[model samples]
Target: MKFLIFILGPSLLAIAVPLYNRIEPRLAGFPVFYWYLLLLIPFGSLCLYLYDRGRSDDRRPE
Candidate 1:
């Protein structure tokens, strides 16, 4: 379960690149593909953050 959450960050990349591999739409003068990859930084961090938070909870006394 927790392992799956950790995988979400990379899994998103594996699943998303092909879907966003285009330049038709632009953001702040940047191609959608470029900005989308940049945007993933925080999103992927959030996924990893969530995974780490969940893992910490598992280590607490219960």
Candidate 2:
């Protein structure tokens, strides 16, 4: 369960950005979809990084 959640969390965000881009209308002369897609790149990276870090922290120290 933990592994699934860890993997799915970033995967969903990756999918959501493109999906949002396809669905959202343009705003302020910039596509909201593009904005979200761009934003999600770093955000997803951060999420993946944090998940991995947390998993590593859970290990019993040798």
Clash statistics: count for each candidate: 0, 1
Q: Write the per-residue lDDT of candidate 1 for residues 1-62, one digit (tens) a residue.
A: 66775666567684776888899789999997888888877777888888878778669776
How does candidate 1 fare on TM-score?
0.71
Q: What TM-score do all the candidates reach, one by one?
A: 0.71, 0.59
Worst lDDT run of 10 residues, candidate 1, spans 5-14
* Backbone clash pairs in model 1 (N, Cα, C under 3 Å; residues 3+ apart or in different chains), count: 0
Residue lDDT tens for model 2, 1-62: 76666668667866764467563476565677777677777877777787779888778887
Name the top TM-score candidate. 1
Q: Give me the overall lDDT of model 2.
A: 0.71
